[model samples]
Target: MSERGRGDRRGGMSRGGRGGAVRGNRGGMGGRGGRGGGGDRRKGREGNNNRQAKKKGGSKVIIEAHRHRGVFIARGKEDMLVTLNMVVGNTVYGEKKVVVEGSSPEEKKEYRQWNPFRSKLAACILRGIRDIYMGPGSKVLYLGAASGTTVSHVSDIVGPTGAVYAVEMAHRPGRELIEVAKIRTNIVPIIEDARYPAKYRMIVPMVDVLFADVAQRAQAQIFSINASNFLKNDGHFVISIKASCIDSTVAPSTVFSKVRDELIENQFKPIEQISLEPYERDHAVVTGVYRPSKKEKAPE
Candidate 1:
């Protein structure tokens, strides 16, 4: 593992620019948008049928829209709800909140789609995270909020007042992110590189939790630099590391070891290390406390 100095400036970073940045999760679909190939007309037809059904369904779980993996179903598929849902509905809005909506007078509609691959909160739970600081009103810096799938869940968890800085450097994904932000005013979209936190600092407020899913080699260093400027001292830092991106030449264990050491050097305390199997291949999720001055503990 090379010490890509902060701002992503390191031995391996020469291939890419040296600015810190994060946000993008197509749930491992390779970040390609919904422009599914080989069936252009079919896409339009399917959308029409779904919309027609939703218009007549009336307070039902209508298959409202289509994304890459599946269709978006909604009960109040009305214009207002549709508009609101587009914002915090499927993106990470940075607030930690749990909304209990009742489908019927006696029924409870309490649930949020948990995408383990994109959002580390679900990944950490699968990895057995005892306590995630992502509950109600928690401020979060959501990195890699591609297309807003997992970010929507984060918005539900964080609620309204709290904010989430959804950062994405990719233009294609950033467009969708902007749409999601338009409805969810709390989420501020920054179409800048994550390696350079200062560049996007004006849009960013202090955050209690920093969640990153950037599949870059110098991720640990990127997180460190971002944390110094953004994360609260005792706040939480959740990172999803793609083993293949780090050092493909060495074993996964070696790569993880090197990255963990670097995090320690940067003053982050590693509390949990987890592997995401069904969701991501040979990928790992790490949850750590940002301790800028304390002695780092041994890797768990």
Candidate 2:
């Protein structure tokens, strides 16, 4: 992959210089001021609707760049992770989010808040993952991209230069993934089981990173298979493992240890690991490299 397709410098996507800083409406007109003087119920209702539309659905909302590249925290009344909406005014699922257009047609830009509870990758970001190795122009292979909720965010992160090969086993979510891919040219929706990487080898390419959030018991094995096939040598990987999926009877700590060992045995050199606690129960995110050359030792 080209260098531009693999590296997106952190803090590179901030819009502050471009006058896209996070905007807030703390001085919004009070509801009491919304009281219509006539006291007519019909007028009152209309006034209320007009005021509500201005407050919630207004075009004054601000979309600011977050600390992480390609990620945004929006401000109006509450804070939310916003993306440049891939599909204008359309939501893939019933996710809690809003889309706002700029003041003029020349400055039209949309943003969507990312939810941590519904997505493991979002949880990882909220949990303070240093580097997911994803950025503008970085190609990614996403396993278990169900319904394209998180994949949408990944698509935003990669921007238009890169691509995401999203693999889903079920036909139901695959349809939605296709719809998301339709809007975002960077996404390549693959309707196939991730367990067998060879099945979709023709469609996938050597990616900068491989991310897997599968719930299968043999998730580590699945990650290894995909890494060997599409992941570039020494490429990074992030996998979300659900303890209950592997063994409900075992403790989460034990489950994580076993999974880590399995990854090591498969030639993966783990770099960082974090628990997706509070946001997710009995879950963890592991970041690592697929393979590495042996380090040389100095002569004694």
Index of the highest-lDDT prediction: 2
The digit string of per-residue lDDT tens for model 2 on 142-203 reads: 99999898999889788888899999999998998998888888899999989888899999
Candidate 2 lDDT (Cα, whole model)? 0.75
lDDT of 1 at 168: 87
Superposed by TM-score, candidate 1 places the C-alpha of residue 66 at a distance from the truth, in angstroms, of 28
lDDT of each: 0.60, 0.75
> TM-scores for all candidates?
0.63, 0.78
Lowest lDDT 10-residue stretch of candidate 2:
1-10
Enumerate residue pairs that collide in model 2.
22-64, 81-113, 82-112, 83-112
